[model samples]
Target chain A: MQPPVLELVDLKKNIKNKEIIRGINLTLGPAEILGFLGPNGAGKTTTIRMIVGLIRPTAGSVKICGYSIADDFIRAMSNVGCIIESPEMYKFLSGMENLRQLSNMDKRITRQRVDEVVELVGLQKRIEDKVSTYSLGMRQRLGIAQALLCRPKLLILDEPVNGLDPAGITEFRNLIRRLAHEEEMAIFVSSHLLSEAQLMCDQVAIIRQGSIVKTATVKDILNTETVEWRLDNPVKAARLLKEKWGIEALRENGNTITAAVGENRLELINQVFVNEGIELRYSIPRQNTLEDMFLDLTEGDEIA
Target chain B: MLRLIENEVFKIIFKKRLLIVFGILLVLITAFAYGQDNSLNRTKARLAGRIGITASTDWKKLCEQQIIDLKNRLESPYGHEEDKPATRVRIEQLQYYLENNINPLDSSAAKFTTQFMEQSIFLFLPLLIIILAGDIVSGEAANGTIKLILTRNIPRWKVLLSKLAALLMLEIIVLLMAAVISAAVSGVFFGYGGWTAPVATGFRVIGDRLETLGVVNVPQWQYALMVYGLAYFVSIVVGTVSFMISVLVKSTSASIGVMMSALIGGNFLSHFMSDWKITRYLFMVNLRLTDYLAGSFQPVAGINMAFSVTVLSVWAVAALAISFVYFMRQDILV
Candidate 1:
């Protein structure tokens, strides 16, 4: 069997006696897009750095294409391409020249491959101009071009769409999806934008305070059902539901209550509310999104 | 490794750093050549006034007259005892020139090239090398490009080794540029006609007395080669040291500043503390390796070619070892 394209087992990092990345375990396979979501200072970048061999992990292993990063860094990194923080190229040289410089470092990368990646990233128009003159989106595209030059099986991008415009973000999302689905490349992207992750990744890992609090398939996260009620006495309804049906509902407002229950229980909830002398104005079944799960799992920490 | 080095060299050239070094050399060499021409004319006029002869008189007569003046000074009671050995060496050098029919005072392109290197080897040439090598690694960190390169599949040691190789290659180029510019610029003024002239070398100092036991005469071009060879060696040492600073420091300006201060401060320390026994062990004091070949008076006694070269080699090796070990294990947090 083909090994996973990227794997992190029991990963941990301590910076100056402070545990930064606490015991992260992750696996990504070909044709998979995993979104590494975390708040600021939540060790998202640190974990990516370890995977790419920029920072050594305290006591864990990062295996890329079945090769251990510590024991076989060259072979491990050869199968991986990454943009750790920002896609910084040599601004003094033209984009084409920058690509050429990177391509020169690896013998497997060819001139034709460089041109193909440039075209793939839609950077052919400004590739001949100095990067100092290129816009942020153009540089991001160029960074992607550089990452794709080696035909890597594992691609890691950190905040890939941070400086991109809405249109550029959509285009980047489409490109990433295509790369994952069409080329069967395993992409591990980190971002603080929950909506972006919701729209992009197949699997989402939400990290908080150096640990992975939740990891789930996007389909499973979105499939989670919650029921909302508009009633006269939300506090009474919340208490009564906990007392009777043993369902914990959040008092969203004076007239609203929401609980993590499916649509099948909505009628029963309304019937009980009506029977218990509580007026039920309306009720609706709500679909939980990745954002709701992320907020709930992270407990409303600062995302950025 | 070769591809990595090619990439480094490509970046250096495109950055126009070599051009800057070349420009500085051009401006300084031209000024020095012009100043040297004026100083030579003034010396000829002074000689004409002293001997009651025209400046165009035969060079052999000038040598004889200079020898007589030196001999009289040696006989005079007012002469300092410490100055006698240097004066004696000068008198013997003029005598040798006179016997061999070589005009020691004649200015030429080859002589000017050798002289420029002799004067620059201690300080000026090292400064140029620092400017070239000081930012090779730190500049990448400052610009955020270090992450790009270090994340590649190649090992960090290979990357650093390639950078060092490219820097050494450029150091040699800087020396060549210095020699070529000095020769070409001075040739316009000095007529470029001393390549075959005999130059006296290998004089030594043995206990406050001039020692000429190893003295030999070689053509001017050969002497220039030896002088430049020493200059190249000094340049490599300085380059390696600055390369270490580049790896240790994360900012280009800071790296350059630290090395510049160390170099200038070393000069000051050497001048003020030459009497201290341990000062002879400092690499800065030994930078004047060419002076030993010229048989010049030692600022700090008991140092020779082998001693200085050994000190410099040790410094280069230590700096390289520190650079590699630190860089290999550095976290590269930037």
Candidate 2:
């Protein structure tokens, strides 16, 4: 069996004696997209930097394809391609020239590979133009193109969709999914867009205060405690359930009543309503979402 | 490593307006050449008129007559005491030329190139070097492109070396530009000659009147080589200091400012406080090591080749060490 594509065994970083990144243990397997979800100043970028060897970790280790980042840095780095912060390149150079410069680091990438990545990112039209002329989306695409040039087994992107347009975001989302599926690459992304993460990530590790508060598969995060019910007279139904069953419905949006309850409570809720004179409308158990889990896990102190 | 250096060279060519330095050098050299040509032409005409009225063909008599003429000119009301040393040196030079039957006005590659280097080596060459190398490291940080470089899996020291190598390459180009421009512009006006002719140098000031001690007759081109060679050396030392500052300072403009003040103030301090023994140890004060070649007079004695080289070397190593140590261990906050 192949080893996991990435392994972080309790990585930590301390800046000025302050723990910027506490112990963060994470593992990403082949073809899995792991979202590093965190609020501002939660050390997402710092952790990524440590993994790429841009900065040394104060404690623990990062293993890429079973190679320790601290002991076998170059080999570990050879397996990883990342942008720990905003995508940046020499603005005076053309997109193609930027790729060519990066290609010097790894001999495996050639002109053919550069052209392929550029075409894949849809930057062939502007590949020859200086990056100074590129729009935010174009630069982001070129950033991805550069990361993809060497065919890294583990790809990390930090806030990749921050500046993209709506159409560009959708296109990039599809491209990332395709890269994971087609190349069998283990991809890691750090973002605050919970909705975007819900759609794009296979697993998520929510970080708060420099520590991993929770880590779970996206499907499990969506299998949360908060459930929504579709019933006739949601307002009256909410009051009736609160008064009769002492079960508080948290919110009522239109004909839907939402409450913090487990999936097993739906049958009991319907039984109680059926015993009353209120006619039972069709019950729709709204799926739990990552957003609900993110807020719940973070204590709702705004994800900046 | 070769590829890293090549990448740095590429960035130097494209990321900054290096051509601006080249262009400014071209314009300044051409303008200086134009002015020198007009003055040289007028002096040539005057010398020819003087030669026309001479009655004797004896070289000794001509020298005597020219000496008297120079004396009378010095005594004239228009001549000032401040101009005495320069005027006296010109007279001494003329006497040597006449005694040897060489026409000083005859434009030769040696004469023009010598004059060109003397005018360039002091402040002009260093100014241009400062402009080109001022942003070597700091500019990368300011542009946010340092992330691209540092993330390349290459070691940090190797990356710094690449930048230093690129700066050295840039220094060579600037020196070459100066040489080629001066040679070309002065060649056009002076009809370049005397490249192989012997030129006398190694003069030292004594008392008030002009005196030449241990005059070495080297080929004109050989003399030009030594002059440009020393200028290039000084520029590198200064450029290295600038690079060191560039690494430490994050703001490109601030880096340039810090180095410029050191350079200008070095010269300023040397001029005002040459008596202070402490000033002799400053790199900027000792940067004029070429002055030792011409045996130029200094208010102090410690500014020599050995002193300058030692100071510059120490500063270079210290700065590079500080740069590597600080950057390697410190956080890249940006």
Each model's C-alpha lDDT? 0.89, 0.78
Model 2, first chain, TM-score of 0.85
Judge candidate 1 against the unseen true structure and give its global Cα lDDT, from 0 to 1.
Answer: 0.89
* TM-score, first chain, each model: 0.92, 0.85
- The CAPRI class of candidate 2 is acceptable
* Best by the DockQ measure: 1
- Residues B1-334 of candidate 2 have per-residue lDDT tens digits of 7888888888788865578888887798778878888886665556546776432234455555667888888889988765565567667767665655555455554567666667666566777787877888898788767777776656678888888888888888887877777788778877777787776666554544445656667777898888888878877777888888888888889988998788888889887786788988788777766666655555454455676778878877787788788777655667
Per-residue error for A270 in candidate 1, Å, reads: 2.3
Candidate 2: regions farther than 4 A off: A1-3, A228-260, A269-285, A300-304, B41-109, B203-214
RMSD of candidates 1 onward, in order: 2.4, 4.7
Sliding window of 10 residues with minimal summed lDDT for model 2 chain B: B53-62
lDDT of 1 by residue, B33-71 (tens): 999999888878888788777656687777788899999
Weakest lDDT window of 10 consecutive positions for candidate 2 chain A = A295-304
* Model 1's DockQ score: 0.83
Model 2 TM: 0.85
